[model samples]
Target chain A: MKKRSALIIIFTLIVGLSGLSSKTFAETAKNNYRLYCSQCHGLTGNGEGIDKPTMGVAPKIHNNAEEMIKLKDADIYTVTAQGGASVTKSALMPPWEGVMSEAEIKDMVKYLRELCNCTEK
Target chain B: MKMTKLTCLILFSLALTLPVRIAAAGDGKTIIEKNNCGTCHKMEGPAAKTFAEALSRKAPDLFYAGSKFQEEFLVEFSQKPYQIRPAGTLYLNHVKTVDGVDRIQDPPLCASRLSKEDAVLASKYLMTLKDPDMKIGVYKPGASFFKIGAKMIFTKSVACIGCHQVKKRGKIVGGTSGSSLYNAGSRLNGDWLSSYIRNPHYWDPMSPMPKWDLGEHAWMQLTNYIMEMKE
Candidate 1:
């Protein structure tokens, strides 16, 4: 009876820990996107927003998965942090590396892949 | 007998001259360049005479303005400027390199900074850009093709109708990204229109319209269609 109870408790702990970790990751991803990616890239990633009018270059719609697939995690992250010019895209996209934390950038890269349904290696 | 002959002659001459007096008179080409139209727009081809290629701009070219805009409409739009056509503004920054990237060191300058006289003169010059090369095409005016064409422009192609006002069942609808197309036919030229649609960035460096890969028929058709927009 004691061994069975102990085993049950251990299994519950593992399940609880896994659930919590996933929840934390999700929350972190949401925060990263809202803070860094939404300005020019847009909340829905449609490339249309208040920023779209004034932007010298229109940001790509992240909803297009095929286009997103061509880009890499490092490329997206560098673009997010370094601005569009760094990636040789548009100066309108400002770099966010100094503005955001390293972990936050990584979180954003993952967030982009998720939002666009892009595969990341 | 002499007085009766003189009166008859005067009456005939006055009748013939009335139509000419009623018509609008102005030299559009002289008006454009004198007013510094080149600052925002590039009507000429690549700068060959100059030592360096002028920084590429974003405003659409006016090289074909004479061929595009009708005279009365040009005078009217010049006097009362409004964002009528809804084509996307041509302000996308040209990427100097293959990656299509550059650093924006400063914000763009607004015309508000200019004096009132300068603004009026600039507006006057912009009114004169009619493309001389635009000969009327074989397409019938007010044909079903134009409606079908405008529909395609709004839907399948650049999706310009999302931001611009195109005639829809006689009602105008769309966002104001650039000017409205309700008056584009009355205000633009065919050759300039074709060149602009082919490459919007060639004229204006700061425009947001993407360089779409369109074919010759579509380009000519769209240009011809837009030139007929008179109010």
Candidate 2:
């Protein structure tokens, strides 16, 4: 009876956790990039996103080391969390504060630096 | 023993006739099941709880079909279905790196080609699946509202135009990330639209749609404007 119960519990655990993944959330900055940022920012963060053609104001290319290097780390964090419109940019870039945690946003700022391969000058 | 045998024969005959009665009556559900619509669309919920589960979903939930869509639209759409969301359902799944440039691919359009009679019957069954939580009659068709103001809010204030496609002076313009709202007035129920705008996560917990902190008037104005779009 004990062996059968243990097997049942193990099966239930596998089935219950099948589609559920923390990887889908903002657990890692790379996962977060795929989840929310990839649609508009492009998978490479090159601003060649699928939505670029229709957007009134193009999404800024995050991978451009020169352009990205001009902005401070705090500025990047602000735009990522508070949105572009808050800093006199496009309203098309909606805020992600509701969707991501502070730590996650901070991590994304770091990720953007990594994507650009440059730090703020 | 003879009487018992007779009763069994009678029962068997009744069972054989039950399907005939159901066919004559509205067996629209049977038609839907026969076509296996559940293979794609979710017919029941407790919706997907996690983002991963939501992403894995192949089609929209049909459990609350009655509350979301108009009967006429549903009936017609089932017969001649087109892709409404330009980026496909869960755009993440369809994004492809084509020629080193990321491009969006089209999701398969429905090819069911249901007969008019079957479409009507199936819609009748779908229209019966209402969500009690959704409050109806929030938007009145003939109510006084300003389109210019509503348009301004949609395109500028909340920037819904960033994702949803809308008509612009006979031109099909605006982003295609979200479902096109060009025919929203005729396609969607007003109450459901209002509720969804306030909180899309209410219906789809893992939806990436941003809920703006706009005033009540702005929200209603946006709803009124969207509900004005047709055909």
Candidate 3:
């Protein structure tokens, strides 16, 4: 009976540990980008998406590596979570704090770094 | 004594009814109709349209304008006739109608801009567009299949709130010249909104608002966010 209980306890730990390690959560961040960001940012993070032609104001291009590298993780996170309003940017870019999760936001930060080929400072 | 009392009662009733009867003599709405407000305005939603069906296809449907606009906003815009957000690329189609094969423009020669008094009256009548019967369901997302997070991104950081309205904590506050999105959830279908966000020209050929640059999830979330605006 003692050995059986120990095994059950060990199994639960494994299950809980695996849940935290699952990379699936990170993937959703990309999906979030496709649905919300793609209209203005382009699918590949290049900045020239389908919505560009009609925009009264031009969206910034994310294609540059040096500039993308200079942006801190906090800056990107702030812009994403708080919106353009927080950073004195366009109000058209509404804040997403009410809509998105903190984890998803961090994942987006990492994904942007990958897309821009920039490393965190 | 009884006869004198009856005469006094009759005279008082006539005094009360005289002004009320004269005030109801003219229908302000009919005066607007005679001037041809229908040529450019629709007074009700597409669901139960009356008083004017011909005008719907000609101009921006005024059916929801009553609910969509504020008193001062409508009066000012009607008098000066400033450009509503330049129609996106779809402006071309708006200027001309596409038939089976041939396309034709239905441009109007008469200007619809109204005088201050008429604009006020028109605004008064137009602002009555609330339909207590129409209620949309709130968006509810169940368990998700993929990982999720809240971090959102914006393009080169333009100031969008300068003209457009967005919902914040069940309150509608923002700019006015652009169409009010106070009830966009009920006003726009999700698929149509998604496509429009990606390319406004795709749906509205003459829209002046530029295209946005967010990804699919971001777009969906934005739509979901807008959908939250309701009674």
Candidate 4:
């Protein structure tokens, strides 16, 4: 009976630790988004950042879950990492490969999914 | 005779110390601090934490002043400040409606003006805050490649023309969100421009400019194109 309780305790601790780590990851991703994307993408991902009005072309609204749901994760990652120009989109979304690490880029993609409340296919 | 000799020795010591005192009296850092320049300007890094704070920033980051500005320009501009960004640094905040017409507000005149002597000292001190990571001659594309770079800047790669005003067909064109790059060739150092283009946040953490992961060749070409935009 004690061994079983100990196993249960270890399982609970593992789950709790994982939950905490994911929360920290999300927080980091949010900070990164604020640093790099929020300037043009807006703090709420509504595509109404201060630079939006001044931009020659409007940035895509990330808050629109319906639209975001249709986009593939790979496509979104490509746009974020390689820039909009790589996919024949706006050049205003400059590449982040030089500025951010691959792990960070992946985190940003995951954050974007969370922002839109969409699940990967 | 002994009293006369003592007087001569005192005079010699005083003469030796006068020049040193005069030279050390006008320390630029002291003058900047005395004027409370840090209240408006960012002398160091790790930009504002929040968007509101970033938007509220009044003056440009001066940490890279050593690497970015020409000494003569710095000295002259400090004494007689002029508008560098026509749209103001935070242009979005300056937009206002006057008489049912929307217009961009004029930037405030630089409140801090230094005398010629103080300006020289300040400029000298500012020029010492160079980014040690930046090395010259990393990329030096020749005049022949300027046309290709111009094309890339306009349409192909990073669309700098989308935000910054550039000369096209003898007419200033492009967005007003950023500082006009029409005279960047004369106003900015090529090395500084290259570093800024590669990673703007390195110079100013709150920079709204997006990072471009252009290869060295591409960035070099863009740099050449920008430097060709002389007065």
Candidate 5:
């Protein structure tokens, strides 16, 4: 019984640490999103930002789950890190690799999934 | 009190000149305020409050006008207003879809042309409203060697090309969401450009552009690259 209790405590600690790490990462990504992407993409990921009208082409509406679901995770990552021009999309989406960390970019991808309410295929 | 005639003459002369100096210096400020230029422009302080307010702003922020504009250009522009932003200050308000393609309407007219005296006075007053924190001395003038690297930074690193027009291969190419930077070198002061790049929020709180954490070297190089773009 003593050994079983020790194992349970260890298990709880591991789970709690992992949860904290993910929550911290998610918060960082959300802050970065507000600072960088929210301007053109919008605070709610609706793509109806102040710059939307000025853009010759409308920004992708991230909240549209149907459209977001059609895109692969790799495609979204490429567009976010390398910019829209990398995939022959609009040149307006600037590459963010230099400005953000690899970890942050990955987390932002997760956040984007959350915004779309969809998961990677 | 017994005063020498020379002392009295000097005192009288000084009083006469003081009023003339004050009139010359204060005329511009009075003229600007009298015209109600603030109705369309923010002559001082931060930008609009909300996104909706930002979109509805009729004119550009004039808080940094003293730093941003060339005096000669301002004077002439005040007398004979011309289109600066091809899509107007709020492009969304002026955009219309035609055959599935977005078309920008003609820019709105500026307030009626001011008389020559008023234009000059207004320009002089406007030029005095500069941002002191805008560091212009860090940038060396006419340094065009960094064009190759700066172009990469502008296009790939920061994606400024997405919204601003820049000259490439002897042709203009870029997004039109922001004003075309093709003539920025001639149109805007390098100092104002650097300050704007450093912190756009300082001038306009509601500006849609994000705050970039670019170091001094990066921003100065970018400024040089922008200033080199003329015509």
Candidate 6:
């Protein structure tokens, strides 16, 4: 009975720690989105950004459910890190690999999913 | 007794002239303070840590203005201020989208043009504030690099035009997210420009500008080409 209680405590602790870590990651990804992407990608992920006026190619609307739902999560990550040009898109969207870490980029992709409210494959 | 008298006389004379010397230096500073220039421009260091704070900044930080800008350019610009950043410093503040078209809604201009006398004094005072860590004399003008190479690097690979405005075909074209580089040669110090282009993160970690690794030679070529853009 005592061993079972200890096991329960360990499991609870593990769950609690993971929840906290994920929350932290969400916060970090939100901050990064505002800092870097918000200029070309609107703060609300509506594609109407400050740089939209000057850019030849408009920034993609992350909140467009239909459009965003079509993009695979991995493709989103590549676009964020490698820029649009790397994927044969517009060159205006700059690569963020130098500015952000790999982990941060992954978190950003997850945040995009959250923004788009896209869970369906 | 003679020696003491001589020393006293010298000290008294020196004391009489010291205030005049001090007043000369203080004139410019006094004008700046009286004008309340610090209200808009940041006179201190430690660039914004968060994007929120960066967006809140009303004007560019003037703490390192000495290293960043030229005295003549500052004086001229102060006297005749014009819109440089089309969307403003923090474009997120001024830019608005209507009917799927992004428009700069009544973009707030910089602090009104200073009077000729005030411009001279304020520019002089601004020149006193310098970043000690920033090195000078690194970028040499007239490096004899092909202009086309720099143009290609700026527009294509590095894509500086995505943010900054540059003169192309005698017309200003490029993005408005960053300060216009049409006459960057006249406005900025060559060494400071080179240092900034190489590693902007060193100055502002939260800078919107991306860090590109285009090698040393390419960076210099780009720098030299920019340096030649004298208005």
| Candidate 5 residue B47 C-alpha distance from true site, Å | 2.0
lDDT of 4 at A107: 89
Report DockQ per prediction, comma-separated. Answer: 0.01, 0.33, 0.05, 0.22, 0.09, 0.28
Please, what is the TM-score per model?
A: 0.42, 0.82, 0.34, 0.67, 0.65, 0.80
Give the poorly placed runs of model 2, Cα more than 4 Å off: A1-27, B1-26
Q: Taking the true A–B contacts (Cα pairs closer than 8 Å), what share appears in each candidate?
A: 0.00, 0.44, 0.08, 0.27, 0.08, 0.40
On residues A31-107, what C-alpha lDDT tens digit does candidate 1 reach at each position? 44533344345556655543355444577777678889988888887887766656666554545554455786788
Whole-model lDDT values for every prediction: 0.52, 0.83, 0.53, 0.73, 0.73, 0.79
Candidate 4 vs candidate 6, DockQ winner: 6
Of the candidates numbered 3 and 6, which has the greater DockQ value? 6
Q: Looking at candidate 1, what is the lDDT of residue A79? A: 80
Could you tell which candidate, 2 or 3, scores higher by DockQ? 2
Give one digit per residue, the lDDT tens place, for model 2 in B14-48.
99997765663357788788888988788898676
In candidate 3 the C-alpha lDDT for residue B22 amounts to 47
Per-residue lDDT over A53-115 for candidate 4, one digit per residue giving the tens place of the 0 to 100 score: 657788777778988988998998899988997898888888877656688788898999999
Error of 3 at B159 (Å): 7.2
DockQ winner between 1 and 6, please give it.
6
Best DockQ goes to which candidate? 2
The candidate scoring highest on lDDT is 2
lDDT at B158 for candidate 3? 33
- In model 4, pairs of residues that clash are none
Give the winner by DockQ: 5 or 6: 6
Task: Report how far residue B126 has shifted in candidate 2, in Å.
Answer: 1.6
Output the chain A TM-score of model 1. Answer: 0.69
Model 6 CAPRI quality: acceptable
Which RMSD values do the candidates have, in order? Answer: 21.6, 8.5, 17.1, 8.4, 10.0, 7.1
Give the residue spans of candidate 3 off by over 4 A: A1-27, B1-231
